[model samples]
Target: MLRKKTLEILTLREGSWAIESAADDLEIAQKAALQFLGKPGVMGVRVLKESVGDIGNPAPGDILFEKLRSTGGADRIAVGEPSSLAPVCEDIEDLFHGGGRTTVNRLFRAYLDKNTVTATEVMHNAREMKRIMDFESMLPSAISKVAQMQSRSEDSPTMGERQNTLFGFADRLNKRAKQAESLDLPSLANVEINEAIHQINKKSNGEAPGYLFRVAASRELINVRNWWGKFAMSVDWAGACKSDPALANLDWFISDALSNASVLQDLLGDQDSLADALISLIEIADGVRSIDTEKAQDATSTEATAAKINGLFKASKLPESKLAVMERVCRQLQGSGALTKDGAEEPKVFREMLLRLIPGTELTGGPEMAEAITHRQSHIINKGGEGGLKAATASVLPALRDPGRKAGYLLSLIESDLGKDLLKDEIEQHLNGLFMTPESVHQIVRTGAPNKKMEKITSIFYRIQKSNLPDSRKAQLTQHLDELLASYVVDGKILDRLDDPNKPLHIRAFMLVSMCQPEMLPDGKASKLAREIIVKHLRRPNFETELVAQVPDEAKKEKILRDFHVQLHRSGFFN
Candidate 1:
């Protein structure tokens, strides 16, 4: 309803007759003035009006009575709009009749009739002012205006005042925007927010202006997000917006606000801020049923948000400066709320990311931390076939030093067939460093070698001789075997004990065969000489018949000789 004021018309006739009545417009005041025209000695009259409530500036008491005091008395009251009044009023007759000749006593008495602002009036006025502001409609424009201020010249004389004005406006707008149980404000997409902040920085040119603008922009973003949070919780936004025109922007506001996660991350790139940004993105991810299903996203919104976050995880080049933030990001990604029920695939992606990340980062313990260990084990074992065995061993040995994460790694080593067969030597080599006692080491050795000490030695020799040992392992084992073989000979000849006729022929043959192992000899002359001895002495007709005659069956004798020939061929003796 339109509010009204009382106009007091004073006529300078018949000892100053006064007429006061309620009116909202000048027409009513003019009509009231005409009432005094017919009164006796009414040469001229003046009219002034005042609202009953505090309607704000241009008070009636100031305009009318101040003019009255300046002009002594007016021939006529200038006709004008209704005026806001002070809260207090005095008696009407006292101003005209009193000797003190106070300024507002007569006017207040004539216009307000000694009334003052009551509590009910004050409440009404406050509500009325609020209705006028319509924060839901004004806040968006205020935010845009604040953004525009960033482009203004910082050297302007009024820049400080402008900053003050913008800040004050933001403060009031923030308070008013949140007045409702829920709130409504502008819908700003993440890209738009990012661009706004970027523009502010660009325009500021890396000076104080840029810093100031960023401060303002950060504040504005916070307000926008806070309002978004309240509004999103207040209603089924899509449903309400469909039926109510007033809520049409609610859906836009929600979609845009939730999508600001990337922009928020960019704005506040510190560890705490990154932590906050990650949590927000998780909440958004959890809230959204699916980008592919419930809410499709555009370049500036939800899909963009998810992309930025995932990209953060995938980025391989993390400098020392960014490690803190990355750590926080990992912590948040591992939280229970980070993934939805159907989002099992997220953990796999997270695990892959953890593999790239864990080498540089030390985990504190969480699902992602656990997943990281699993990934590290897989990385070691699955990298580049047998070619990568050394690298895999190099990788696993260090992680196995940490007792807490060691169990899974040790189990991976023990349980895998390739790990057991191919990595057996490498693993056992680390068992001492892995905190096993001598007895435990003996047990693992017994279980693994299982009275196959000779077999294991033979296998190592076979690998060394065939040059099948990885180049790295071959160099060490070959040198050790050469030194070991030298110990058995005197002056580079077979030991005299074996050469003595006191030794049995088969025993001498076996001893000579041990010395004939190509792996036990050095590569050049020694290996050629060892092969010569094996072919000349060990493969002789007498030696073969003596060795084979021990086998009972004639068929077994022939089979054993053929197997012996195959072994010689494999040892490269035939070639």
Candidate 2:
């Protein structure tokens, strides 16, 4: 390499040096004589004195020059070329030969300190050095040292001192990591991050590592906005589902997995995929709902409604819908920095499920909606711990108020034993607050009852009968039922042949008694009117035949008869 030199021209005046010209070179020094004299275009400008030396690498005397040379000073330095890689290689080798953590630490610092050296260049050099020194096998241990140093630093007496050292190491390593992000660096970064997370989980027993997630997110090791996008783009979801039912969880972690708070935030923010998964589960549950509703619609007596719920989870894809996978997603989200104490925006899919399941606002994230209604109901009824009817009813209220799915959802809620009793006093209070209109009620009924051709019809009779609504609302409900039943009762006579069978007659009668409160008549006029209708029906010779035909089980028949006798006695009919 050639070095640029400068010359200093001076005149000896009264034994003091007087500068004439300080030029870039010896030739320029000669031309600069006249210029320095303030007579560049004038004649008779005489040269005073001249001498030259290296500008930045000046040697004062022979002894100084010898000392500088001995130390391999500027004389040995290369110009317009980067420093040799030999030193970096030597330092790496020294570290491999037990130079300790500092050696590796210094290597990273030196690699990043060069203005000319980028992460790509350092990556190339590191690979070459590894190959030349046969240091591939030692890489794992060196990487392990980085993590070990960090872990040890945590135990140091003074936090500042340990933090300084750790930060110093991290500062350089991260700079290199940013440049060599695509370099495939012996899995050092991966090992370190995994170690940190593993240690945190072990210590905290699976608590999320908020700080670590933030750090990883800031580094872009994971794509926050589209964490799952990359993985989703890589694999065929259908194929994975077929191969393993638990693949959703695997795909979540394996796909451009979380590396930072931003990515985690993005993951939590994105709910479409999670919603789709939940919707899939709901569709399956709705399938079972359809079966139960069909059986209820076809049955002649309530005893048939007691048949066990079965074939709900019969789909082969059922295993893929594990709650653990959803829980894993929640775990990833829970660790996000976005979920600060001030209550940040929640993850989308989980929030959607909550809105559909819980009673509060759109942001509700409680686990009240975690399980399917049947599973939750079964859990509440069969197991004795923690669950109460009040809670179950509160959960169902959101469904009841939903105009789109209220009917089917409400039916599903009442289909189970726990669900049937969910309509308690407090829940009815919530229902009243909903201000459910006749139209919404019509939609619910339509959705609940499917016709012979499987076409859905609006039928609020079941909900009206089952709900524990207050008298005022019940009276309003009766008006709606009267309007509905008017089509069946014209000129004060039953017009539908279907009512003559007495099976549906019981269902209609139950709905009427639930609405009218027959025992509350002041003058006994209402009671007499009710009894007259009942007697007219009972006097029909085929009443016994129709009753037996509807309830073939003799014990169930006895129970029905016994209940009617008690109802009649209470209504002042027997007296």
Candidate 3:
């Protein structure tokens, strides 16, 4: 049987080699590598061929063909130990801790990406440290770049001072590198990380769990090239990480990677439509893992993914993952362009998508999702030019026939930037027409049952309170509503129920007391009238005796009287 073969193109930058591309054919891989070798800043290129044993149970195969080439010039620098002012790193842990690891990541991102290596890989591997130290221009380039950036700030150190600080950092790294070489420290490849950590702890006073974790994680990432691969590798380690307090850094690393924009984009993949992208993003934000299917690996079925996302949202343990996912979704939601695949703002489609996003926004506690939706609305309105505002306002006019729907539509418009800027007066006029009109007040107070009337009154008051309407407008509307309620109470003879001879004295008192509650009567003329009526009854001769007369037990009668007095006091009826 013919051996299954694969070929890869590798590029050299400074002293490091990174895999650039891969192909199934040797000629295609070699041509691609040769073409890349001639590009500016590319020091060299190598094409290596490998044999695969089987489809299901593949084994590592020998290199069947290999070729290497380098551009002739100053680019071909001999691998020599470069000198710089040492940094403050005292050991392997110091090199990978704090800002040191960030610096390494920034300096060697390309190499890390190409090799599927992490900063953790370099920190524990002596050979990797040596490889970095051999890059003669790496430290100087990093120093110069940092100095340039820092020099832009008014409070920044002088270039020389900044250079000295960076050089000191470099010197520290060099010192640690030399120590690792002298000690013949084993690479992550030579020994398992847990064993390495155990061995190191025996020799040293301090334990290095965080350091060892990164080393093992890096090994797991070996030959994995894409962002999805990194994300998956990080996720696989998450369960193991939860048991060890020292693996907090590993958890943070995973979170940080998941939170990255590029990583999220890759996770969503190239969906056929924006709607597909949106559903996939929601799934990720909701902490739904991709399902592996027989037809395709790591395939995300939209319906299945959304269902899973909705189910897992409340139960998800990974809140950071959800946050990261929502942030990306928010960005897409607010981004410029039509939301639909056909490049048109279809209202029905937009509404459906927004409906889907609302639950996600609540699930993730992201106000940005709401804000983004408003921004998108503004964009759609602005795209229509001057007629946009007029058209939107006209669209709202149809809903005026239905007060509840009108209120909903108006509130949505008022929350948007364009609506705030251009339609403030219009929105305020509409709100006043809706709530402050004499007909509107009469319609609410006169039509419903006592409870239904109270519900309608309270609903209007609540809408006013929750709106972004000005304080003065809110106060005016509330005062008007209160006045109308007070008039209705008087005109409808609602207080006359308290003096009715047919009802029991306690029943009349109970009804009056219920009206005095904040829920039933807000702080206004209506509430004041209810309180005064209750106080009048409370001050009447033999009122307590009549109030509790039906109670058979002397103790119960006394308790009822005392509780009534307390309730009256709490309701602001001092008398």
Candidate 4:
């Protein structure tokens, strides 16, 4: 392993140092050097006093780049062969490890980008490596931590205890309903109805009795028992005796399903069974919604208008379509580092099932998710403590197609993992970490629903930009940059500046660096633009800065690597 070297990393305009000549590898070095130095305001190490081309040596511009062998002082470094920049994430991780502040985190990211490297194989491998490390190392720990905190906080609340009681009450209500006449066995009808009346008597509310009465008047059982006039108009039963088709209308199948729904739901319990049974019972409720459910397919202006669009989904009845929709959504979730194939464990099974069932759920993860996730840390207030995020996620299940709503589930998981001990700062910190993924970028932009943390960060950015961004409203610079860097527009230009060369070097550099973030450059254009920037502008001494004490030793050849970055910045390659 190479010793980690402290490098005085140079920018386009920084000081120079010593470097070993490496003309023997000049051909490869030149192209790599050219590529690295093409971008303006290039960030790299300055390892040499003179460039290879300057000394008139064979392959004059190239120099050998390595960590100093015999304690070569900083001055001993000189220009050298072009070098491969470190992987973007690993580099940023290193920067963080080195105690770089968030500002530097932003700056280095905006400038020296891993996207500058062109090899797809290399980038893919690096990204995959990073992804694996993040998932394997970070996810479980994050989840457990959140769960623990939530559990602890849950204990603090009288509300959670109450909610639990509500849950039990809800369960008991269902059990009581099952004992009612509608769902109970016919032989038990007399006994159950009596019991139901007893329970009804206990209800001080006249509403409960009325609801029970409607269920008690089951026409089907009444006809079999010939018990007319007791709970219905005796004439209606007599009308059926004349064999009138209208009188015998068994459409009560629908109404009966609906009227008995509450009791049935209680019998089934909550969760999936209850959800499914309730959905079925909605048909009866639909009848109730209509003035005449028998004429359900009858057209009014509204139904007539809706008919055209209603031809989708339910009409298609294509299970494959459902699966495809689920697949698309799951892929997006997977890409965002949210879910994926697990060798030893399944992805959150409920979410997986929801994706499979709703198919359209993937689409729901936009604004709805954003709103849900951003509902505040207090939303995940525990089962009954308050409005907690988890409760919010459950409540908004029907809105799963809204990214904002989908965001709730994601946020809850994160909240659950991080737990309540994580103050606002901790939540924001984790979110900052989470937002680095390509998936998160897409969710943020498409959904227009920003997470709590992103909202804060975005507010801060616009605030600073308003005050400090140059007053040059010169011909819409960023729009122009987007055009030139379209190839580099990963998921669309996140911060596409660089319109005028006359702009401040740091500003230009900032835009250049933004194009390099993985979230900002998923489209693979970051490297293309970076190459152009490096080829033109990376040799000057005033366009950039040199961070000598920071670039650690493990870099294969420190001087060569640093010089490579500097030249790239000088060449206007980034612009």
TM-score of each: 0.21, 0.22, 0.42, 0.19
Candidate lDDT values, in order: 0.37, 0.34, 0.57, 0.31
Cα lDDT of model 4 by residue, 1-575, tens digit = 97443222222323333232222333333323322232223323123223424332324233333121112365332222111111112222222111211112222221112222111111113332234222211212222222222334434434333333323332333343344434322221344434444554455244344334323433233333211111122122222222222122212211122122232232223434322332322221222212223332554322321231122223332222222222233223322222224422222343444443334212233222223233422222224333454444344443354333343344433333223332334433433333333233343334442233223223322222232123452123222223333422333443333524556454455455444433333222334565456334445563334223233454533663465456445533445
lDDT at position 125, candidate 3: 50
Model 2 over residues 390-494: C-alpha lDDT tens digits? Answer: 554455444344432343344333333344354434434543443244333243343433121011112333444444445676566545544433332342343
Which tens-of-lDDT digit does each residue in 314-418 have in candidate 1? 342112113323334544543434333344444344444434333321232222333333333344345555546545555654543333233334333433444
Give candidate 4's error at residue 396 in angstroms. 14
Model 4: residues with Cα > 4 Å off, grouped in runs: 1-309, 312-349, 353-426, 436-575
Q: Clashing pairs in model 3?
A: 85-167, 85-171, 86-168, 86-171, 86-172, 87-168, 87-169, 87-171, 87-172
Q: Which regions of candidate 2 deviate over 4 angstroms?
A: 1-272, 280-312, 315-404, 407-488, 491-575
Deviation in Å, model 4, residue 168 alpha carbon = 45
lDDT of 1 at 178: 37
TM-score of 3: 0.42
lDDT-sorted candidate list, best first = 3, 1, 2, 4
Worst 10 residues of 4 by lDDT: 115-124
Best by TM-score: 3
2 or 3, greater by TM-score: 3
Residue 446, model 2: lDDT of 38
Give the winner by lDDT: 2 or 4. 2
**Where in model 3 is the C-alpha error above 4 Å?**
1-383, 393-416, 442-448, 466-468, 497-500, 551-575
Candidate 2, lDDT over the whole model: 0.34
Model 1 segments more than 4 A misplaced:
1-451, 454-478, 481-536, 539-541, 544-556
* lDDT measured at residue 320 in model 3 versus the true structure, 0 to 100: 45
